[model samples]
Target: MTCLPLLASASGAAIPLALIIPFVLLLMLIAVMPLMVAKVKHWWEHRYPFVAIGLGLLVVVYYLLRIPGGGETIAHTLEEYFSFICLIGALFTVAGGIHIKVKGSATPVGNIVFLAVGAVLANFIGTTGASMVLIRPWLRMNKIRLGAYHVIFFIFIVSNAGGALTPIGDPPLFLGYLRGVPFFWLIEHVFLIWLLVIGLILAVFFAIDFRAFKKTPSAVQSEIGESDTWRFEGGLNLLFLLVIIGAVFLPAKFFLREIVMLAAAAGSYFSTPRAVHAQNEFNFGPIREVAFLFAGIFMTMMPALGYLEQHGQEFGFKKPAQYYFAAGSLSSVLDNAPTYVNFLELAETTVRAEEPAAFAALGDEKHAAVRLLLERRPLLVIAVSLGAVFFGAMTYIGNGPNFMVKSIAESSGVRMPTFFGYILKYSLPFLLPILALVGWLFL
Candidate 1:
């Protein structure tokens, strides 16, 4: 979920430890339920929406009845949730209307090239948009030799890290833009690190894919060697995609942005031919699951966020590396967008407290604190931005696009890793080291 300005006003005494239980339990259930016995898994699949909502309601009720200024917090959170789901649902709907068909099997080299292209495209259309549009074609191209690594690496590159260069690329960066950072500031600062991280991840992906490629039978290799052909359908949806992306810049008043996105989605949905929809196998199931689950996530995490905001400085984070790892660690479980915002606010608070005279010298200009922070402590911003974006790949629920990509892949018959399996198999072994290296070198 994206951050709201109201989050900054969640000022009060610290939240009780017990109040955080629903959030912890929800996360545990999300992680463990899919790995359980078939009966339990089946039960979870059917009942998760109810469970998520029920738990979320517990926290909501507690906040409304017990806490001061709780209603405003919930209202702002629901607002963020609505905007979040609108963008996600619109992208899912619009992208589903456009179908890409790859006629030849994918070679390791070809797959790497395709992923590289996706990384660049993510900066323009956003991770969610790029992931939604490219995932089906990616799956189709590698169907013969597809493995969990394929989807996992796709999540690492295209769905998360690839979207670091621009505000439109990811929700956290976009919120950063809305908060006062310049639109092109991220690319200006993080371009090299972005290239380095993307290059290294691609290299790792290539080595693994090549080994798997060698294991394919000669007949399949020969088929893969065939000339690749591409077909594009529902070209009109490109305009709708642009509309959704453009809507991000709209003022978030009277639901204008969400309305624009919903309108585009509707226009794309009704105007597209049935054959394209059938070919894409587009349905509302993935988006539906995401909406229900995140509704709970956004609500339940309110107290956790409030707790962090109130006492974050006590954690003794005073360096860029600390912010990087701390923010990344939290982003691994919490939604990265809000995680980014919280860490950003933390950085601001730290600077103001540490250097009151310097902060005061900046006067009361709009976003003067952010400007001063940029001038004096640029690396903190860089670290938080990188951490939030990169570590979002650590879990399915870390970022909006991660779960959607997993759901899409699974619906296409790809046997994905469970929540813990994803971390153990991919995030811990492959992604964490690269991120740590980046933090060590750059932050």
Candidate 2:
């Protein structure tokens, strides 16, 4: 169960608050059931469909009967759902084929270095790509002394915050790029906030890791034993990785992007020897789980997004701080890619109403959007960008890498935090304070 921002309704239409109860209940179930019901500890993997599918059917029926564009919405949603699952599955499949073998005990400093390097790599390779490449070695090295906080902090930095500086780094930034925003515009605007968030989070992680490192038993440390050189295998998969990147920039209408990515995934599977997959311990289970759960998410979110698109400005969310929290809060649970586009649309529409000619200039020129954004409503763009990326660290579902990283860690024998445990224990206490600081400083 999960909640996303629901619109008030279209054009003064009075859709009842109860119209969104199913979505809220689903989000709540996803958040609370694991912690409350032992049977649901793996609900996302095994049992989510009961709730997801049932509620999804209800949503489909309601829209078909009551809404004007309901059928079209459903078709579009199915398209998006397939696209989302395909891209995520392809990335997971390709990344899993490339294995990094390490021969060393994971010291506190060494672990920090790995995460730091991953944080930087996320920009060029994407959060999903970087996480897949580095997560196994990170887990194996720290296996003897691993703690839940290690995974938590890794998600906060490497899986989420590290991707802030480049459009290729995160999905929301990529959307901005596809729009008129320049490739380096994000770096120019959001670099300082990214550095501050990463720096503060790293400091907190080092302190926690130092304590955990000291508490590790000598017997366990002895199991890690010796150090040797590192080896990388299945280098051919790197070519497939490039294929996935190239496909992202392709037009979505012809289904070329999906076809290319799916083919690359298949190519990686056939070309990569079974031994490499064994080394990575790769399987389709996690991606399948994400695909199923997100199918429900996309189905249910259609109306809610429709409402937001139509009625968002009516809610009087004119301030940058308002967009920051509103967008970020939803991005915490919803897919940040669409959430980013939604808020971007809202921001652009609001700005255009005030200065139509200036905003129109943004369309014809390359960096005009960035320039107009920086000059007129810089905070709005920054808020939307930062909120989408940073708040994604709040939940396992917030960003693509968040779930992938969790699944990888669990496969490596690390006990990751539950969904609610993540929000209540880690994000609320740690990330929220930092977010508040970011708002106070920048927004």
Candidate 3:
């Protein structure tokens, strides 16, 4: 089996191990980051948007020499990569300009129930769709529902899990479908994990929400004149998201269409500049952090992927179950689309080997594969899908939507935890255990 370009043409294949070693060096460099991050000069700024961009440039430039397909395909993927961050950042920042932070009044228990139900609703509206629609409302609800952890829970479940079963709901699942995983495969296999995560999170949410609700007495009886304090100042960024969605809906496999759409979006943003004293004032720092780190991961992991494809079978990774857990674990931290691609390559390699016997039977050019255990396909699909959506809740920066919610929360005077702070205080303590349960019970 040969290596295929996800963004480029399939012209280049079979990348050598010798070619991938430099990236291994780069990974080693980052592996000791906990030691390096402290030694930096201006830690905060360098830690954020700049760090992401700098790392991205470093990795891409390093790998550009080794990886083939140096034409429009490489150019296209590069454009798509940076453009995704920029556009998403621009829209996020601009959105902050329009809406004022309004508070809500609800018990933590009720808040948890509301969000648990909200995740289910997100599926029909679309995860990204729901993120756009409900984020502000959730923020408003939290305005009055003071000291509630429901926002994070909302991000973990409604913002992420709610989209696990459908490609339309999450970008990663869409990538899987594009790579030949069936659209309905997620629902058939992955929904159980989604439900488990949701159920557990909701249960936790109920405990915390209820506890908080009890501590804070209702202000309903007081002379609070302004009941509807939540105001909605419409921003043009929402319209831009709709356009991006429209552009994405087209089978514009490459960045040509996305580029054109992005160009139009850029034009619209420049033309309709928001007031200086915008609501939250969107920052690129967070998205910058994600872009740079993932770019390094994306480029360097190309080699790791090459090795996996050729040798996954040697390591007794022949079943769909193995692929499921493997892809899921990587997708938990690594960006999900590329993780899906890596596994797809492995699947192709394994299937191609059976071609001789299969060819002897059906004699098809695109050789058929013997299905693994009946549980293999479903289990694999579910693991990847569930991990992509659910584990994102494990960290604030794990998913795009998670940061968006955090930023919105912080702007509204809610002191959301810092990076490691968030993990130690919230994610590592609470979420990991449930995630482990899901891994055991399902994956």
lDDT of 2 by residue, 322-359 (tens): 88998899889876776786787677656656677996
Q: Which wins on TM-score, candidate 1 or candidate 3?
A: 1
lDDT of 1 by residue, 75-126 (tens): 8788878887787788778888888877655888889899999999888777
What's each prediction's clash count? Answer: 0, 5, 10
RMSD of each: 3.4, 5.0, 5.5
Q: Least accurate stretch of 10 residues (summed lDDT) in model 3?
A: 365-374
Q: Which model scores highest in lDDT?
A: 1
Return the lDDT, model 3, position 439: 76
Q: After superposition, how far is residue 295 of candidate 2 from its true place, in Å?
A: 2.5
Model 2: lDDT to the true structure:
0.75
TM-score-wise, the better of 2 and 3 is 2
Tens-place lDDT per residue, model 3, 304-366, is 555655565666566555666576565555455566656665665565454545434644322
